[model samples]
Target: MSQKSLLLTAKQGSFAVGTTPIPKPGPGQVLIKIQSAALNPVEWKIQAYGLFIEKFPSVLGSDIAGTIEAVGEGVTGFAKGDRVLNQGTRGDNNEFSGFQQYALANADVTAKIVSSLSFDQASTVPVGLATAAVGLFNQGKSNSAGLYPPWEENGSGRYAGQPIVIFGGASSVGQYVIQVAKLAGFSPIITTASLTNADYLRGLGATHVLDRKLSAEQLKAQVSSITSASIQIVYDAISEADTQVAAYDLVSSGGTLVLVLANSIPESKRTSDRKIVNVFGNVNAPDNRATGASLYKQLTRLLENGSIKPNRVEVLPNGLQGIVDGLKKLQAGVSNIKLVAHPQETA
Candidate 1:
C-alpha cells in the first residue's frame, strides 16, 4: 500500500505533496484510511514560526475523521473499517497527522465516530471540542451555583450553575466553549465578539455577546451588569494582552481563567486568588498521555451523543494541494469557518 500527505518543506513555506510507503500500526496503534482532516490556526502558525515541529517535511493536521484499516497489537474494541475520529497530536510526529491519505492513530486517543454526523463534521471535532471540554471540566472544581451545566458526572459532582464567560465566542474554540458551557448548565454564557457574529454567538448559547472592539471600560461594564458574581470561570480563546487584562478584571478573587493560547497572561495582572491556565490542546504528547486519554474518551462520548456539535467546516475540494490555499485563508482570518481537506474524494 502507498500513501500521500501534505508536507511543510521549510519555515514560512507551502505544503508539498509527499508520498510514503503505507505504514503498519505499532503496538496499541491503528492505521486509518483518512477520509477528512480539519485545518487549524496552529497549522499556519507553526509553519511560520517553526515551533513544535522537530524537522522539515513534517506532516500537519490534528483533527481527523476516518475508517480504521488495521489495528495494531494490544488494540481491541476497534476493528478494521470502524469509523472514527482522533485527536491527531501524539500520532502527529508519526506516519499520520490527518493531512495524508492514511495515518496511524493510537488506540487510546481515537474514538468511534458518531453515526449521525458526516465525516466532515467529525473531522472538525477533535482539537477544538477536546480543548473546550478539558478547559471547562478538567482542572477546576465544578460550579454549584447553577451558573453552568456539567458535561460529566465526576464522583466529586457536576457543574451546578456557574457564571462563565467565553471571550472570542465567534472563533471555533469559543463556539465550542459556548455550547459546552450551556450543556454544562453555565448560566449566562457571556461572550465577546464582533457585532457581525453576535447573533451567531447567541444561537450557539451565549446569553450575551459584547463587542470585543468596545473600549475596556465599556466591555467591563457590560460584563459587570450581567452578573454581580465576578466571572467564576473564563475561557479566553483569543488570549491577547488587552483581553487578558480585561479577563483579570472580570473574574473575582479565586476565579479561574483558561487560555487556549500560550502565555498571554501577564504576572502583574494576576491576583493572588485568581488562577491562570494555559491549555495546550495536544494532550497526547507523551507526557500527557495518561490524562489526555481519559479526556479523549469522554469527548468521544459527547460527540457520539450530540452533547456537542462540530463547528462549521469549509471543505476544500482539491485534496492535498488545497492545503496551501487553506493555510493562506486561515492566516488571512477566515470567518465563521474551519477548513477541512478531504483526502478521500468519495468521502
Candidate 2:
C-alpha cells in the first residue's frame, strides 16, 4: 500500500500533497499510522530559510503522535495498536521525518503517549519538552528532581534555593521548563512574557513574570528582586541579541546559560566562570539515545500521571490538505497556541 504526505519542495514554497510507497519497518523500527503532527517555529523557519535539509521534496515535521501499525524484526515491547509519540528524524529521506500519513520511527525514539492526551497534545510535546529537559538537566545541570532524580543531591548542592530565569515563558518550551524547574525543587522560577500571557505563565509555575516591553534595566531589577542570589541558570527560548545581553547581566559569576537557537555567541560575552550552552533540539541523535529515550519515557509518565500537563493546541480539520494551511498559519504567527494537523479521520 502507498501512503500520502505533504512534502516541502523548496525554500518558502508551498507543500505538495503526494503519494509515496508505504515504508516497511527495518530492524529496531516500528511503522506508525500518524494521527497528528505538531508545528513548531523551526518548521516554518527551516522551510523559509532552507537550512539543514539537503534535498527537496522533504517531510519537515519533528513532533509526531500516532499508533503502531507494524513492528520490525527484533523490536520488542511494542505491538500493533499502541499509541506513541516521538521526535521525528532530521534527515531528508528518513521515513519517520513526519508530515506523512505513515512513518517508520526508530524503536528507541518512540514512547507510549499518555492516555489522557489527545494526539494533538501528544504531538506538541516531544520536541519542546525534550529540548527543555536536555537544556535544564543535561546541559545547565539545574537541580531539578523532575529530570535527574539520581542527580538530586548534586543539583541540590549546586542549585537548591537558587533562581533560574527563562527568557520566553509563554513559549511551549519555556512553559515546560518552568514546570520542570518547579518540580525539581528550584525556587523562584522567573520568566518573561507579554502582558497577555503573564497570568497564563504564572499558572504554569512561574514565580515572577517580567513584561517583555520593559526596559532592560527594569527587567533586570524585577528579576533581581525575585531572588536574593543572582540568577544562576538562564534558558533563552527566544535567542535574540538583546535577550542574550539581558541574560548575561542576570547571571552572576559561574552561572550557566543555555540557548535553544544556534546563534553565534560574541567573544566579549565569554567569561572565565560563566558557560553558555546551545541546544540543537536533536535529543535522539545516536550518541544521546539513552538520555533521550529515558527523558521521553519520563515525560510520558509525567503526562499520564498528571505530574505535567500538555500544552494547548489549536486543531485544524483533518487531512493532508489541512496541513499546508496549518503551516501557513504557523508562518504568519497568527496563532498563539501550537497548531496540530490530524491526517486521519476519526469518528
Candidate 3:
C-alpha cells in the first residue's frame, strides 16, 4: 500500500511531500494511520546543522498520534482501531517516524489516548512528556536526575516541599517538566517564561513563572525571593548557552542541572560540587526503552485521571505540506503552544 510522506531529500536538504510505500507492522509493532504529526526543534536542527540523520530521503518526526491500522505478532493489549500516540525515532527510522501518513510504532512504547484528546493534542505528548519524564525520573542514568519515578507505587508526591526550577516553562518540554515535577511533589515549582504564559503555566503546576526576559542576575534574585531552600534540580528545556549558565548557577552545591542540548558551560566556571546533565530525550533509544515502556503503560491512566495534560495545539493548514511552513514557524519561535499537522490531509 502507498502513503503520503514528507521526506527530507538529503542532509541539509529541503522537505518535500512525496509518495512512499506504507510499511507493514513488524513483530511487537503496530502500523498507525497517522492523524497528527507534531513539529520539534530537533527536526529543524537536523536540516540546518545536518545533525543525527546521515541518510538521504529520510522521514523525520518524533511525535505522532493516530489510530492503529494493524497489529503485529506478539503484541497484545492493543488492537486495530485503537487510538494511540507514540514517539517516533529521532531521525533513526523512516518507517517509524511521524512524518508519514502511516508509520510503524513499537507496541511497548505506544499509549492509548483517551477520547478527551484530539489527535493534535495527543501528538504533542510523546516528545515533550518523554523528555520531561526521562530527564527527571529515569533513575541511575547519566541523562536523568536519577530520581524516583512518581508513577510507581507510592511514588506520587515523593518530594513534597522540595523546590524545582525549570527554564522555558512555555516550551513543550518545559510544560511537561512542570507537570511531572508537580507529580513528584516538588513544591514551589519555579520556571522562566514570558509574563503572558504565567497564568497558563501556573495552571500546569508551576508556582512561580519568572519572565524569560529577565537578566541572569534578576532571574536569580526572583528565584531567591521565591524560596529560601536550596535548589537541587534545574531543568533547562531551552538549553541555550545563556540559559544553561543561569540554570547551572541556580543549582546548589552537589545539585544537578539538566540541559536539553549539549553542555556549553565554560570549564573555568565548572565546579566539582555542581553537575550538568545533557538529556537525550527520545525514549526509543536502547538505554531509555525500559522507562519509556513503563511510562507508556500508565500513560492512559495518567491522562484519564487528569494527572497529565497535553500542550495547547495549533493545527496548521495543508497537512504534510503544511509542516514545511510549520517547521519555519517553530524555527522562528513560538510560545506556550505545539504546532501540529494532519498528515492525511496532505495534498
Candidate 4:
C-alpha cells in the first residue's frame, strides 16, 4: 500500500506533500496508521538550518498517535487496532518518522492511548512528556538530574519540601515538567510564563506562576517570596542563553539545572558547584530506550488517572499538507498549545 507523506524535498529545500510506500513492522515493532501528527520547532529548524537531517526527501516529525495496523514478532500486550501514541525518529532512511500516514514504532516505547483522549490529543504527549520525564528522572548525571522516577516504588511525593524553579512553564515541555514535578512530590513548584498562562500552569500543579517578562532579579525576588527554601532543581524549558544563566544562578550549590537546549551559560558565569544537563528527549534513541520503555509502560495509567495531561492541542486542516503552514505558525511562535495535523486527512 502507498501513503501520503510530508517530505522535505532536500536540505534547505521545500516540503512536498507526496506519496511513499507504506512500511511493514519489524521485530518488536508495530505498524501504525497515523491519525494525528504534531509539529515541533525542531522539524522546521532542520529544514531551515539543515541540522540533524542529511538525507534527501526526509520525513521530519516526532510525535504521533494512531491505531496499530499490525504487530511484529514478540510484541505481546499490543495487537492490531490498539490505540497508541509514540515518539518517532527522523533518520537517514526516514521510515520511522511520523510525518507519513503509516510509520513503524518500536512496541516497547509506544503507549496505549486511553479512551478519554483523542488521537490529536495523544499526539502531543510523547516528545514533551519524554523530554520532561527524561530530564527530571532518567538515571545518569549526563542526561538528567537522576532523581527518582514517580513510577518507581514510593517515588511519588519523594521530594516533599523541595522547590523547583522552571523557566517557561507554559511551553509544551514546561507543562509536562510541572505535572511530573507535582507527581514527584516537589513542594512549591515555581515557573515563569506569560501572566495569561498563570492559571493554566497552576492547574497543572505549579504553585506559583511568575511573569516570563520579569527580569532575572525580578523572577528571583518573586520566587524568594514564595518559599525560603533553596531552589535545588531548575528546569529551563526556554533555555535561551539569558534564561539558562538565570536558572543556573537560581540552582543551589551542589544542585542541578536542566536545559532543553545546548548549554549557553557563559563560561565567565559557569561554576562547578552546580551542574547543567542538556536533555536529548528522543526516547527511541538506543541510549534512552530503557527509560522510554519504562515510561510507556506507565503512560496509560498516568493519563487515565489525569496525573499526566496532554498539552492543549489545536488541529490544523488538510491533514499532512496542513503541517506545512502549521510549522510556520510554530516558527512564528505559539503559546501554551500544541499544533497537530491529521495524516489520514491528506487529499
Residue-level lDDT tens digits of model 2 in 120-236: 888888888877777766632332212353233444234458688888888888888787787776778889888798888878888888887777799888876777786678888
lDDT for each of the candidates?
0.77, 0.76, 0.92, 0.91
Going through the candidates in the order shown, the clash numbers are: 15, 2, 0, 0
Clashes of 2: 2
lDDT of 1 by residue, 251-305 (tens): 7777788877765666776678877777666656554454557656676677776
Q: How far in Å is the alpha carbon of 126 misplaced in model 3?
A: 0.3
lDDT of 3 by residue, 156-246 (tens): 9999999999999999999999999999999999999999999999999999999999999999999999999989999999999999999
- Badly placed stretches (over 4 Å) of model 2 are 139-159, 334-336, 345-347
Q: Worst ten-residue run, lDDT, model 1? A: 140-149
Clashes of 3: 0
Candidate no. 4 TM-score: 0.98
Every model's TM-score: 0.90, 0.90, 0.98, 0.98
How high is the lDDT of residue 328 in model 1?
84
- Off-target runs (Cα >4 Å) in candidate 3 are none
